[model samples]
Target: MIRFHLKCDQDHAFESWFQSGEAYDKLAASGMVSCAMCGSTKISKSMMAPAVSTSTSVTPPKPSAAMLAELRKRVESASEYVGSKFVREARDMHDGLVPERPIYGEAKPHEAKKLLEDGIPVLPLPFMPSKKTN
Candidate 1:
């Protein structure tokens, strides 16, 4: 599977997975590929950086410290930290004991699967701060 960064005429950006480049073209031509945010069909692939190169002089760009701090702040503000009690907290919220709120926590894969099976919305965050052990 290949992931493509796509943009719609409405300036909405999103990623889509396609089986192959040919498959992406086929779907786009058939009007099957639509923007998730705006539901616009006037979508096109955005320019992507080359995946591989023989040149060793090119250096990968790094995220600025300010950008990293901003990302951390966004995550911190957007979700409540439940630590190791993620599963229990999630279950509590699902049962309506606590008011619904965005939360983030660590859970085993099995726990996450069970939560999903129970129809609770959950997504794995790409980055999570390590729990300090003192």
Candidate 2:
């Protein structure tokens, strides 16, 4: 298998695994490959440095505090916080009782599975701030 670092036009970076380079080319040419975030068909491999073995020590650069703060702000502003009631609120919205809106919150793994099984759209946030912060 081969792994490619891919980027969409929106600059969302992700990785895709393929059987081979030819397989990737075929899928991409046919528009079968798309960005998970934006559903954009305009995807391409991003340039990446060759991987080194774990035996070779390498230091990864950390994001600046300012950058992290900006990211946290963006996350907070982009979605509504439903807190621990994520599953209930999500179900309500999905059932057309509450108006649908972008939301982020905590849910048990089983709750998430149930949401998926029910065909309700939900995605876990990478980070969740404390309720007091909101």
**Predicted model with the maximum TM-score:** 2
Stretches of candidate 2 exceeding 4 Å from the true structure: 1-12, 15-71
TM-score of 1: 0.49
> What's model 1's lDDT at 37?
57
Alpha-carbon local distance difference test for all models: 0.71, 0.71
Summarize candidate 1's per-residue lDDT along 1-134 as a digit string, tens digits: 57788999999877766656765786577565666555677999998875665757887456567655555565565567888888998899879888767667788999987887776656565567444221
The number of residue pairs in model 1 that clash at the backbone is 0
Q: On residues 1-134, what C-alpha lDDT tens digit does candidate 2 reach at each position?
A: 56789999999887766656765786677565666566676999999777668887887566567655655666566567878888999899879899867567889989987886776655444455655433
The residue pairs in collision within model 1 are: none
Q: What is the lDDT of candidate 1?
A: 0.71
Off by over 4 Å in 1: 1-10, 16-71, 130-134
Steric clash pairs (candidate 2):
none
How large is the C-alpha RMSD of every model relative to the true structure?
9.8, 8.5
Clashes of each: 0, 0
